[model samples]
Target: MFDLFKEKLADAEQTVAFGSRLSGACESPVCIYLHGDLGAGKTTLTRGFIQGLGHKGNVKSPTYTLVEPYELADWQVYHFDLYRLGDPEELEFMGIRDYFSDTSHCLVEWPERGEGVLPPPDIDLTLSYAGEQRVIELQANTEAGLRVLNKL
Candidate 1:
C-alpha cells in the first residue's frame, strides 16, 4: 500500500523549493531514498531540505565522506551519498545502524549501492532530467511516508 506524487521542476530553484516543501512534512524519524543520475539535482534538493530544517551552513554532498551529519535545533539529519561506496558491507563497518535512530531523519543518495546494508526507506524520490528541466517522483512506502505525501 503506497502513494505516489509527481511534479515537474522548471529549474534548480524549483527543485530546491520542492525539497524545502518536503522538509516541512517530515517531523519524525524517516528514511528517504533519493535516486538520480550524476548532476540530477540530488544534492540541490538535499541542500534545500537541510536548510529548511534550520541548518545555517552549507549542505554539500558527502561523496567522499559517505555521510554528513547536521544537528539541528530539534532534529538530527543525516545526508548520505553512497555513490562512491565500494561495498555495501562498508556501511556495516561504519556503524550504519547508529545513523538511523528515533530522533534522526536520513536522506540517502544512491541507495541502491547500499541495498543490503541500509535500512528500508519510508519514501523513495527519483529525479530525472527533462531536457533543461527536471521531473521528480515521490513514492511513499510506509504510513509515515504516506502522511508526508498527504501533507504535500
Candidate 2:
C-alpha cells in the first residue's frame, strides 16, 4: 500500500508532524531506505525524524563521513549518506555491521551504493519534487514497516 504527503514547508516545525508520525511507530533496530533525486526533501524528512527522537542539534547528511550517529534517551539513530562511496564493499571495511547493533534505528540515503551490504529495509520512503511542492511516498517492506505506515 502507498500514501502520499504533499506540501512545502518553509521550516522544520511544519515538517515535524510527519517526522513524529514516523517516530511514533518506531521499534528497535529499524532500517528505512530513503530514495530521492537531488534537492528532494530526504534530508529534511530525516531531520524531522531526528527531532522526533529528541535530538535538538542540527541534522546534516553524512556525505563525506558516510555515517552520523545520534544517541537519545530512548533510541539510537544512524543517518547514512553513501553519495561519496565508490563501492559497497567499502562499507564492509568501515565495520558497518558493528554500527547496526540491536538497539538502533537506521536511515540510509543512496542505498543503491551499498546494496549488498545493507540490511533489508523495514520501511522505504521516496521523495520527489512535485512542482513547487514536495511529495513523499512511503511503503512498508516488512511487518514493522506496515505497522509504522498504519500509524501514519
Candidate 3:
C-alpha cells in the first residue's frame, strides 16, 4: 500500500532496507513512476533500491540531465528525472523507446512530464511530504506491479 511509503523512512538505513526488499521482489521488466514534490526522498529511496541491486555510486537526482541510467549486476535501473523537460515529445528525441525494448527496470521521477512518450508504468510511487516526514503511496498499475506489492 502507499501507506507504506507514508511510513517514516527515519534514516537512510531504513530507506535502504525497504529498497533492498523492493529490488529483490522485482521479477520482470518494470516501469515505476515516482510522484512527489521537490526534496521528497524519491532519490533517497532510489538510492536504496540501486544499492540493493548492487550499484555503487552517488544516486543523485537527474533533474537537469533528465535521466540517470545504471547497469548493475542484477538490474538495469534507469532513473529519469524529467523536471527539466519542456515537453513530453522530448522523450522521443532522447530515444526513450530504446529504453523499453527489453527486460530493464525503470524508475522514473516526474513521469507526468513525459506523458504519452513513455510506456505505462508497472507501479507508481507517489511521495508527499508531511513536514519532515515523507508519505509514499505505491500503486501497482500492472500485473508486474501487483506481483511486487503482493510479495511485499
Q: Which candidate is the best by TM-score?
A: 1
In candidate 1 the C-alpha lDDT for residue 81 amounts to 98
Residue-level lDDT tens digits of model 2 in 1-152: 44443445544455566776678778656888999898777788888898888899999989899999999888889999998999999999999887777788899999999999998888888877767666667878777777777666
Order candidates by TM-score, high to low. 1, 3, 2
Tell me which of candidates 1 and 2 scores higher on lDDT: 1
User: CA lDDT, every prediction?
Assistant: 0.94, 0.81, 0.80
Q: In model 1, where do residues sit more than 4 Å from their true spots? A: none
After superposing candidate 2 on the true structure, give the runs of residues whose Cα lies further than 4 Å from its correct spot: 1-13
Clashing pairs in 2: none
Ranking of predictions according to lDDT: 1, 2, 3
lDDT of 1 by residue, 35-146 (tens): 9999999999999898889898988989999999999988999999999999999999999999999999999999999998999999999999999999999999999999
Pick by TM-score: 1 or 2, better one: 1
Tell me the TM-score of each prediction against the true structure: 0.98, 0.89, 0.89
- Deviation in Å, model 1, residue 128 alpha carbon: 0.3
Model 3 lDDT, residue 126, Cα: 80
Compare the candidates by lDDT and give the number of the best one: 1
Model 1 TM-score, all chains together: 0.98
